[model samples]
Target chain A: MNVLRAIYNFIFELGDTALLFLKALYWSFRPPYRWRELFKQMEKFGVSSVSVVFITSLFTGMVLALETYTGLKKFNAESVIGSIVAVSMFRELGPVLTALVVTGRAGSAMAAELGTMRVTEQIDAMYTMAVDPIHYLVVPRLITGVTMLPVLTVISDLLGVIGGYFVSIVLLKINSHTYIRQMLNHTDLHDLYSGLVKAAVFGLLISLICCYKGLSTKGGAEGVGRSTTQAVVISSVVVLVADYFLTAFMF
Target chain B: MVEETVIQVINLYKSFGKQQVLKGVSFSVKKGELFYIIGKSGEGKSVLLKHIVGLITPDKGKVLIEGMDIHQATGVDALKLRRKIGMVFQYGALFDSMTVYENIAFPLREHFSLSEKEIAEIVKEKLALVELEGIERKMPSELSGGMRKRVALARALALNPGILLYDEPTTGLDPLLTEEIDNLIKDTRDKTGVTSVVVSHDIWSVIKFADRVAYLANGRIEFIGTPEEMLETDNQMLKRFICARLEDKLMTSLFNACRSRGSCTS
Candidate 1:
């Protein structure tokens, strides 16, 4: 019964959150907007997150290449390494890995930031100023996340492919031409399009979970910590679950 | 001198689960009045202020600000009504990431259609009012406790709010800083004509700054009178709360802290 109640409350919360996002979107285009805040959030969410994303993507690509080459060589399919890496990176790994990294880096920080504000009444202060907290804090983050995640995924995919290329050509002695040809042959616009869509969704999910958890935080420092942890956990789980359904439906 | 009632609370009741923090709490603040909610610490002073600002809704009863029923007000109306009230939190509640200038300028930027130059001018004026003109570039963490409160005050005044609600404005300050804050509050009230409702246990503040003092006890207003009247009251709770004896202070602090912390934990 407790589990059932939890699930019920979760669904209700999710519905309310979706409504909030819609309201945030409505306010995004409304006047008295804070363009400066939006730009600042973009920089914080997108620009500062690049180093971690880049490092994680590079290593993920290299590892995928190594693992795939080891198994594919047994089937005499080593020539298809680039195609496998490119397709997998575009279709699944790029968006998923970038999102997971961001959930740790940006999502936790966002939760902590807003959670502190919530407890300390800075968010309330915003409301008292005739400014909606959703419009000021959540909307800019939503916009940044929705717009930047796909771009970040594309960058991650490119870097991952480069890492895979290096591993294939340098370590595996696979011809670059064959690798490139196979990659181009197997992957299509549909694969890239699906990945970008997933990236956007993942971005929205991360921002929503983080912002919701932050705003709901009560108590003081301990509450902020709990919200941060919950934001990361919930976002990561949601990203993985959504990825499964999206992939199943798309395929 | 004639006085207008800026805030009138009628039978306000608020509870967290089974623990009732405020039970039929009622009070009023006259226009431009320096009012203080004096209690032994957890007598629902902060909770009462939160209700006034519509941060928390009362379980029963009404909170009328100027004339609008806040708990029943629509979101649009509530937002409009909130614009007339400003709050300074105990911890200053400054945005950690933003500089002092950005924090103070937040309300102006959010509410008005002012140009950058106009906003800058207002920001400068507020900073100057708080005597923090040159430290606009400093973050909240860099500022001392007293400075943070001043910045918070400047932010609260950014919209030129008619009503100012301060929650424990001198909680963690040293003696000198507490007096400094008291003076600042008086100065702000004088200059802005903002109806000030201060929630604090600082007896000196109650004695010096408050035109009227309301002592909260047992989730209700135990006493409401002028500072002189409050000091002269024979009510044991009011007397003990005002005397600041170590045992009375500890018990009050512990009770209030436990109540707020307990509610938060649950």
Candidate 2:
């Protein structure tokens, strides 16, 4: 009975969250839209997210290359290291991993910031001033996340391939030329497109969930912390789950 | 007595879960009236003010502003109605990210398609009204609490709203700042002729500024009269609350202790 109740609450919460997302989107284009606020949010969400995303991608690429090269070389299929790293990074790992990192770094922070604003009545102040909170806070985040995630994922993919190349040439002593050839042979436009699409979807999921949780936060400081935790956890779960379905469909 | 009614409330009922905060509450404010709703904390004064601005809907009854049912209005109409009503939150509720200038100019920029020159003029004028003209470039955190509240008042007055709602405007201030806020409220009322609804527990302010004072107790209006009438009231609850009597203090402390314990036990 407890489990059933939990499931029921989860479904109900999901429905409510979906409705909020639609409301936010509707308000995005309405009059009294704050363009300056939108630009400021983009700077916060997209520009500020770049460094963490870049550093994480670079390190993740290096680790994936090291692990995959070790496993592939055991079967004497060392030359296929490039294709292995590239396909894995672009088709599966890059979007999902970057999204998880962003959920931790950016999503939680966004939720906490907005939740504080909500508890402090700053959001209500915006409403009383004829400024829609949704347009002022959420829409720019949505736009920035949707646009920037794909670009970040592309960088991640490139870095991962480069990492694989370094391991193949310097560490594993495989011909760098052979590694590049194999990667080019197996990787295609479809792989890149699928990854970009997944990144966009993940971006939407992260921002919508974060903003929704933040805006809905009640109580006070404690509630803000809880919303931040919930935003990160929920966004990470959704990103991982969505990645599986997206990968299945793409393949 | 012949003054036009600017805000009318009929049988307002609001509840949170099983706890009713406002029970069949009703009142009306005449145009240009500085009406004060006074109560002990948790007596639903803030809740009533929120309904006036349509921030929270009453579970039952009606809130009418200028003859329009607020809850029934469409989005366009609701926004239009809201523009005529300005609210200053208890905490000042300044946008932390914006400077005082941007904070005061927010409504002007949102509501009007004015040039930068016109916006600057209006912002300066509102700032001058609140005696905050020079500190426009400073962030909210850079200002003192009293200054923040004054800046908030400037923001509320930017649109020349027909109605102004202040939620505990003089709370947590020294006597001097409190007096300044009272004077500012009077100045604003005189200059704009805005119908002002103030929710406060400040007895001194109520005595000084309220043209009509309403005492809230047990989620309902217990008394409504002029300040003189309120002072002469023989009601025990009104007397205890207004006088801040020792028994009233003890009761409130006991109530808070029970509420905190209830939360812990639950």
Best by TM-score: 2
How many steric overlaps are in each model, in order? 2, 0
Model 1: residues with Cα > 4 Å off, grouped in runs: A1-16, B244-266
**Candidate 2 residue pairs that clash:** none
Expressed between 0 and 1, the share of native interface contacts present in candidate 2 is 0.74
Q: Runs in model 2 with CA error above 4 Å? A: A1-5, A31-34, B246-266
**Model 1 over residues B59-140: C-alpha lDDT tens digits?**
8999999988988888679788988999998888888888998898777766677898998899999988988878988889
Alpha-carbon deviation at B240 in model 1, angstroms: 2.7
Q: Write the per-residue lDDT of candidate 1 for residues A1-251, one digit (tens) a residue.
A: 99999999999989988887888888888866668888898888888788988998898889989999889989999998898889889999999999999889889989999999999888877776767788788989998899989999999999999999999999889998999999999989888999999999999999988999999899999999998999999999999999999999888
What 10-residue stretch in candidate 1 chain A is worst by lDDT?
A123-132
Model 2 scores a C-alpha lDDT of 0.85
For each candidate in turn, the TM-score is: 0.90, 0.93
Q: Write the per-residue lDDT of candidate 2 for residues B1-266, one digit (tens) a residue.
A: 67899899999999999999999999899999999999998888998999988889899999999999988887879889888899999889998988999998888877779999999999899999988878889999999989999999999999999999999998898877887888789789988898999998977677666789999999889999987788678888898776675565664454445334422112
lDDT of 2 by residue, A70-130 (tens): 7877898888878888998898788887788778878888999899999999999888876
